[model samples]
Target: MKTAEYEIVRDFAAQREQVYAAWTRPERFARWFGPRMFTTPADRVVLDVRPGGAWQATLVGEEGFEVTLRGVYREIAGPGRLVFTTGDPDSPGDGPASVATLTLEECEGGTTMRFHQFGVNTDAEHAEQARAGWLEFFDRLAEHLAVQATSSKVSARP
Candidate 1:
């Protein structure tokens, strides 16, 4: 079967550790895990953040539909890189599993994130849609990080 893939690169005005935590920490991940029209409750997100550990998140859409994504950690290099496989939890081996890789590098001002997902069991059109969805999710992440940065600064003021 022909597989689809997508790559996205983003730069955030936050430290690499902070950006990595946004992906590894469940509380922070839930805040920005889904598309703009969907919300992932913190209770619905689980991130073990260890190789062989499992992670999952269910996003509830505005129209009342739910989408759940579950995967297992394949590799984790804290504050640097992460690799995981995404597939249906209930039904394994039904199709090719998608692998997602995220690499974070310290840049002059902040962190540069490179994200790539491949091995999707779908066509190009659907893959493009998935890319768009991720773009929306990243937009939310940018906002989340900005808010956290502001709050941290406010609390640090003496």
Candidate 2:
């Protein structure tokens, strides 16, 4: 039933340091990474950003309700690569965990980063939906990365 794998490659004219920071830091994580389809909590984010660390996020439901996502980081290859699961409670079992991989490569202008989500086939419709969802998310990410770069430089200026 699971039958969806997708890859989105985006190269930013932003600085690599800023791009790397946005992906690794939890503060930056909340700004860009999320469904963003509904009203999401910008402050309710906790990502350890390391192997064996926890990644938690909570979104308030209608009329004071809250939904949670609990998972752990499975792999970390420094600034170049990162692999983790979003909803894997026990992580690395028979059940497929959503695998998120980010790769950063330097380019002539700035940096080329590829975002890949490889597992999402629980159902035919779900797989298709995920593909569409990731495409939208990547678009958001591109904008966020650029802003992050500009903000960092402005803050660094004395």
- In lDDT terms, which candidate is top? 1
Best-performing candidate as measured by TM-score:
1
Each candidate's root-mean-square deviation in Å?
A: 2.2, 3.1
lDDT of 1 by residue, 1-158 (tens): 55898899999999999999999998999999988778899999999889999999999986789989989999999889999988942344556467889999999988999999986466787678888988999999999999989998999999
Candidate 2 deviation (Cα RMSD): 3.1
Lowest lDDT block of 10, candidate 2: 88-97
Candidate 1 runs further than 4 Å off: 88-96
Q: Candidate 2's residue-wise lDDT over 43-137, tens digit each? A: 78787888989878776656877777657778888777777776662443555457778888889888888877766434556656776766766
- Which lDDT value does model 1 have at 64? 89
